[model samples]
Target: MAEEHEDPGVSLVTVDGIEGKLARVELPDGTLEDWRLASLPQGVKEGDVIRIDVRGGDVDVDHQETDRRHALGQRTLDGLNAQTPEGDLDL
Candidate 1:
């Protein structure tokens, strides 16, 4: 069997199709994190290299907790999009 891997950090990959100005970043562990950019920030584009930052905060691991966190993040992302004239899109 292959060895398991740990999440080193988050990694931002190239942005795919655009809609509301959101970009899909590839998480360190192969998951995707939709980053809502304010007017697609400078130097950010397709095939551009970027790093994903994870802040130190409380996180719940249980299913319910995971769902809660996910929802919270989604809400935060939505707020970010709302703040900008150009809405955020998902990948």
Candidate 2:
């Protein structure tokens, strides 16, 4: 049998301050993680959940963008040379 448990991730973060569009969150591990909450109230303070998300790949913006671009580029080239959901495409 396998035990069920939440993966080690960010939680119970105390919000320090919101400078512009950034929310500085202090994690349960005593480290800080920055979050971006667009159009939401910055009222989260000193002790709050703030937000919850996958901490690893989701936080690597540059690497994520590069990966996405590479995937799309590969799909485009593949589609142009083969049959795809978009129908036969021209290169």
Candidate 3:
């Protein structure tokens, strides 16, 4: 007879913080785990919420949240650029 195994169902997690290329994630059960940021979808950042499919070992980004964050970041960058002195060329 073959043995049966249970699936590790998908989990909803939030990005708590990032250190280097690793992201500290808060699991659905309130536990924290570190996952490689490179393994996750592009543009994931701190405070972003994402869905992790354990069985498939895949991570999905929350598009709406990501888009919102992206917009906010662009605004901040624009503000910084506006404050820069022209012809500085300090790349």
Model 2 local distance difference test score = 0.49
What number of backbone clashes does candidate 3 have, counting pairs of residues 3 or more apart or in separate chains? 0
> How displaced is residue 54 in candidate 1, in Å?
6.4
Residue 89, candidate 2: how far off, in angstroms? Answer: 72
lDDT of each: 0.47, 0.49, 0.71
Candidate 2 lDDT tens digits, 1-91? 0111255663234455577777776555677767774523344433333334456523222233334545776887886767666666665
Q: Write the per-residue lDDT of candidate 3 for residues 1-91, one digit (tens) a residue.
A: 0111233566667788899999998776777889998877788878776866777877787666556756886777777777888722232
lDDT of 1 by residue, 1-91 (tens): 0111244443233343344667674443455567775434454554343433345332211244234545776898888888877778564
- What residue pairs are clashing in model 3? none
TM-score of 2: 0.35
Candidate 2: how large is its RMSD? 13.3
The C-alpha local distance difference test score for the whole of candidate 1 amounts to: 0.47
